[model samples]
Target: MSGQKACCHGPGYGTPLDAMKNGPREKLLYTVTVQPNLDEPHGDYLATVDVDPESPTYCQVIHRTFTNRTGDELHHSGWNACSSCYYIDDNAKQIPKRDKLILPSINSDFIYILDVITDPRKPTICKIIDGDVLKNHDVTAPHTTHCLADGNIMISTLGDAKGNAKGDFILFDTKNFDCVGTWTKGERKALCGYDFWYQPYFDVMVSTEWGAPRMFRRGFREEDLDDMTQYGCRLNFYKWSTHTLYQTIDLGTEGTAPLEVRFMHDPKRPEGYVGACMYSNIYYFKKKPDSDDFEAKKVIDIPAKLISVNGEKPKALNGMISDILLSLDDKYLYVNNWLHGDVRQYDITHPENPRLTGQVFLGGAICSDLKNVEVLEDKELKARPEPRYVKGRRLEAGPQMMQLSLDGKRLYISSSLYSPWDKQFYPKMIEKGGHIVQIDVDVVNGGMRLNEDFLVDFGKEPYGPTIPHEMRYPGGDCTSDIWLANDGK
Candidate 1:
């Protein structure tokens, strides 16, 4: 925190942006972060948090409200293309005036639009594209959402009408919030779609897959492993300008369940990283010079956390690398292993190589790490009869979703992935409840320090224990913000 700025930073927030400003431009104060709760029986909505590091209640939940219909598990979220409006010493065309978030539930058919502009403190649901919108589009289970250069909210679906993972994307108008149409134009088919990132400068976008919606909906099962069609293992590239399929690269067996996709913050940089969940690998891809072809290389593999059943090792390592995010400077890469129970930071200045600089285990499938620590008496954590880590505060669930401040000072962690899976993997998450921990990052030196004082216990909510997943901060965060036009030429 010495030379770095205390404020939140990103492509358009604290940095001297180049794109013109819109709406109430008061230096874009207030760090409003939002995440979805995956509760059943009419209990899911975006959870808003105040993450302004300078404020007194920096990591406190300022406000929260329920959105989707009954049984819809709220998941991933992204901004409404407002990021393209800022420029840094370079004049770039400003995006259409919009200050809302496009949130979609992967388990349900609806998409909820959260308007954070009217009242930063109290975010309200402005509109919702009912399940019927998805029905008409012949797609189901909306997953990752990204803002396009033309201000269209590009949402990738998990299944088709018949529930195959041959998913597609839908577009929404940011100005008035209307379902434009299915983004898929040509017969370009994606076997499965989980997460995608686009670079307008390269006129290219890449997508990775998890599996068929039907398989993942019920959580991880032994049947999924035996069934070949259950999970997806392909990465697809698209010609952004035309929405045409550029190339499809089968990641083979190693890149199973590739979840989150992230590109370098610098639009000109073609390299990026994606988290492979099931196999527990990190695949980084780069564009082949002078051509549209791209290649994905396995750069990192997380050590598997295996369990012994009846004095024998289980077949697979339970290390689920669910979420990965890059710092605004694109020098640091942060990822959380939901199953292994640790969040690790890697220095990625060299695209081919990533150096692990920091790591912390919160407690997960294996408990051998802890045998004598005193358990913490807290609203969110439950101490087992037998101890695990010395801290005694073992996470009831693995780290699910994560969001980093624009300036790369703080990284917020949550522990809910899917409603069904949350129960399957971390059953205690519902009873003990999920928690959000704020970790301080030394951007210049490369390290992480858990800020114990800054913790948000989702289990302590008035509405019973609710699990939290996929969070986004207003203005811009590592995952949500997108650019439309570039530096004014």
Candidate 2:
């Protein structure tokens, strides 16, 4: 914290718009990368990449910090404080800065607190709250980590200690990272939980479901989709102040696996969007007029493609929209289709109708073996596009996770979804490892093109083949932040 400029707001730019206009450009990226298999001798770790173009080590992973345990399966990471705490009365003293990161293991139930204040580039582990601690609270399989308006941190838990589908929220102190008990007030009503978003101004919180730990730990099975007990297809809405589930909207089969939920960047607006991974669709949700609760409608749908490999019978493959995020300015929404190998940019100036402005393919099942594969869409035969190559190397794996720069000029993407899912859908990714690529965004015109010169190949690291997951910038980013101020403030 010596050289870092002090912020008047709690820990981030005052508002999403302020962040877009005033936030400094990112010089380094902190990424979570896991080994090829779950049984690695060395555990999953955080890899720091140099993003500054002028730096000598630009586009290279300069540092790696490994966790103590071997099989943690580290996923979505969050900060201890952000712009959301702007309204805290004593925020200047209670939340001095946003230096600590809360990283949770979806498999082991362990939580690691990392201190980046000493050095943002090379963060060291300050504390590790073991798996049993969370089990003691009757919650395991921690997924999303978020900081509330107060100094406390709230995380969404996917299952009970026995590995059953029990959706609950866990709370912990910001200073000690000690268990403050479950956040939900009464009995757990949600069948399962995955991702969540909150808007305090409207007193609303929306969470999506994604089955239990036992159902998806090993790998994804097609039969699991048919079993209601194994997979989830509903969205749960909660009262933000009371921490109680108020309503649930069943998306049916077409909206199975509603994974990531995102509210608009404007804190005043209650409208948002969710990505359904299994069904290949995006559903828009908003507060019903003259009501406190909400309703959801399907706004975008991607047709599944028929794929055949090695002269086998054609199989229908879903696009598998793994991740989505809105630009800080909230003018465009970006979505990635993991199976179809395409990242699409949609202009959402009108919240109800999204217009497609740009699209690009990386690599996926359809592009796995271009020469020997047959691809069809709807009822007509279609030719698969040639494989994408960057820096003379063929790009493998589809875009699974994405991070947009605060300025909305550059988009960063990682190719690995989860270790188990990576092995099932793209086995080659396990052998060669996942990679991170950069896509230059045309902010003025709303289009995207691959930046061929910038690439971070995890397969070439000192450690054996590893897969990169989620990413965050040292300063706040588009996906990891929420603003409490209204637009045009």
lDDT of each: 0.69, 0.85
Question: Best by lDDT, which number?
Answer: 2
Clashes of 1: 14
Model 1: what TM-score? 0.85
lDDT of 2 by residue, 88-185 (tens): 55225654468898889999999889887798888989999999988998889999988886778999999889887878889998878888999887
Superposed Cα deviation of residue 448, candidate 2 (Å)? 0.6
Q: Tens digit of lDDT per residue, candidate 1, span 1-489?
A: 011122212235322123212212212222222222433444676666765557776656667766636656667777775454343222223324447777787777777887878886777888877887887878888878777645578888878876777757888876777889887668868878778888767878888887787787767786675554557777889988788887988887778788889887677788899888887889999999999889989999775533443455444544788889888677888888786677899999897799999876665654444432222222222432221222335567666678776667777787777767777766767677777777788988999987766666665666667777766655566576654334431
Estimate the overall C-alpha local distance difference test score of candidate 2: 0.85
Query: Where is model 1 poorest over a 10-residue stretch in terms of lDDT?
Result: 1-10
Task: Give candidate 2 regions above 4 Å deviation.
Answer: 1-8, 90-93, 378-382, 486-489
Misplaced by over 4 Å in model 1 are: 1-42, 53-58, 85-95, 227-230, 309-313, 369-394, 484-489
